[model samples]
Target: MPAVSDLTSHIGYLLRMVSNAVSQEFARKVADEGVTVAEWAMLRSLYGGDGIAPSALAGKMGMTKGAISKLAERLLDKGLIERTGNPGDMRGHSLSLSPMGAKKVPVLAGLADENDATFFSVLSGEEQDRLRGLLHMLIDKSGLSTMPVD
Candidate 1:
């Protein structure tokens, strides 16, 4: 008979457990501000830019074009983002944050900082830096550029 592996002994399982806790906590906090993590990612991506192509934003976020379009529509409905015809490509539109979105970005970012601090308060600054570095190293080694969103 083959031996049965214990899931609790796996590093990936431990990582997922912690990741879920952190992400869920952040999700709740951001929901209080009327957005999902995905929406937050979209807003953050558009914060400082002049306009970017939908395809570009999608690529940067590691999301599909359809997902980007849906997020864009929601932002447009909220008047947080505006779409303008692409100068170089008439068939395409560039998306940019509206003034309202520009104002909200900082507030949302502050919430994000608070959420992270709340969850990671147990860790010292050095520990936090180390954890981040390790995670970045893993991401680089694995070639994992996908944005975490739900």
Candidate 2:
């Protein structure tokens, strides 16, 4: 076997560590706002769209439908989202941010911007763009459409 120093380190390991740290920090920052990271993501997705099917949202978020349903239920309980019967498909339902939720998305979006800047402000604009491109490439190559946490 090759020596550790000579062996290539797996990008997945590093990505997981960094992502977890960022996620944890973001969660802490937003906890007082009464939204979990996952919930925030769902809200963000619906911020502008008229409404989306739960199944479609699941696919868009790269999560299982069960997970999406659970999150949707929580948001409903919080009055952060409203669910309605889909006219196009009676068997399915659609979701949109509630009036309060609609109002809060922009505030939450600002928080998200701050969180990103807190972590990435060290990089120059060019470097930040390059890093984003590289990360997208890695995700594309790895066939990863959703965020990953370890």
- In candidate 1, the residue pairs with backbone N, CA or C atoms under 3 Å apart (3 or more residues apart, or in different chains) clash, namely none
Score residue 47 of candidate 2 by CA lDDT: 89
Candidate 2, residue 128: the lDDT equals 90
Q: Write the per-residue lDDT of candidate 1 for residues 1-150, one digit (tens) a residue.
A: 999889999999989998898889889888888888898899999989999999999999999999999999988998889999977888989999999989988988998899889888899999999999999999999999889887
Q: Number of clashes in every candidate structure?
A: 0, 0
**Model 1 misplaced stretches (Cα beyond 4 Å):** 1-5
Across 29-97, the per-residue lDDT of candidate 2 in tens digits comes to 667789888888999989888899998998899999999999999999999999999778779889999
State each model's CA lDDT, in order. 0.91, 0.86
Error of 2 at 53 (Å): 1.0
